[model samples]
Target: MLWRPFGINETIPTTIGALTVLVAGIVPWMDVLNIFDIIRGASLTILSTIMMSIVLESIVFFGGLL
Candidate 1:
């Protein structure tokens, strides 16, 4: 329904439709690892940076320069 990739939004995701149809499924198919995969990688990198910050803060709290 989001995309009007047919004769002016005529085809629906149903068996009766001319186009390919899938009743109920995942939208962004994370299993295939597309854009979501890149987002996940970026998130992981951010989390690693947060961990590094926490470690540095802890070290400073314990009287360390780094």
Candidate 2:
């Protein structure tokens, strides 16, 4: 048989758990960015910093740093 992802038997709760963790991890820094300030005066500075850091970490994670 051909290969298949998750064996076509995935469940909704598992998917939700994964997505929840992903967002929780990112939200704090997003809060710092002040994008929340569009209505309150916060800015994008922190969000930008977080994105750049993720990119750099991704590179290193892929062994580009070596």
Candidate 3:
């Protein structure tokens, strides 16, 4: 039997997509309004996703020890 963390499959793709968005936000190609807001939101999304993954993995690891 193979053991996989919950949402592992979805997490990778989501993180990748978020990173792509973040990069796009960083590039200043157009003089659009609220660009900073876009960058901030994307950064927050990436950070939260990473933090959530860490927490979930830790929980799974500790739970397995019990």
Candidate 4:
């Protein structure tokens, strides 16, 4: 009943892709537009948190095998 562009039922990846395109389009004008500066700190914090989570998960996964 619903349209699936990516050929799968999950929509999260599609949504992220769309957002990435939108951001890419706006990146060229980031210097002229100060909006990115406003969120830079928050974005960096979120990215670091995600990176740390992945590192911890990998350590635990490998530790279990050893």
Which numbered prediction scores highest in TM-score against the true structure? 4
lDDT for each residue of candidate 2 in 1-66, tens digit (9 for 90 to 100): 365576754566578875787677955666555654564433366677788889988778646633
- Stretches of model 4 off by over 4 angstroms after superposition: 1-32, 61-66
Off by over 4 Å in 1: 1-23, 26-32, 61-66
Model 2 spans with C-alpha error above 4 angstroms: 1-42, 61-66
- For model 3, state the Cα shift of residue 16 in Å: 28
How high is each candidate's TM-score? 0.41, 0.29, 0.37, 0.47
lDDT values for all models: 0.62, 0.65, 0.72, 0.76
Off by over 4 Å in 3: 1-35, 61-66
In model 1, pairs of residues that clash are: none
The candidate 2 region of ten consecutive residues with least summed lDDT is: 35-44
**Residue pairs of candidate 3 with colliding backbone atoms:** none
Ranked by TM-score, top first:
4, 1, 3, 2
Better candidate by lDDT, 2 or 4: 4
Order of candidate numbers by lDDT, starting with the best: 4, 3, 2, 1
- Among residues 3 or more apart in sequence or in different chains, the pairs in candidate 2 whose N, CA or C atoms overlap within 3 Å are 37-42
lDDT (10s digit) by residue, model 3, range 1-66? 264567367568678986787678864445334676569888899999999989988889546655
Model 1 over residues 1-66: C-alpha lDDT tens digits? 566765564434453442222224433345445766669989999999999989988878656655
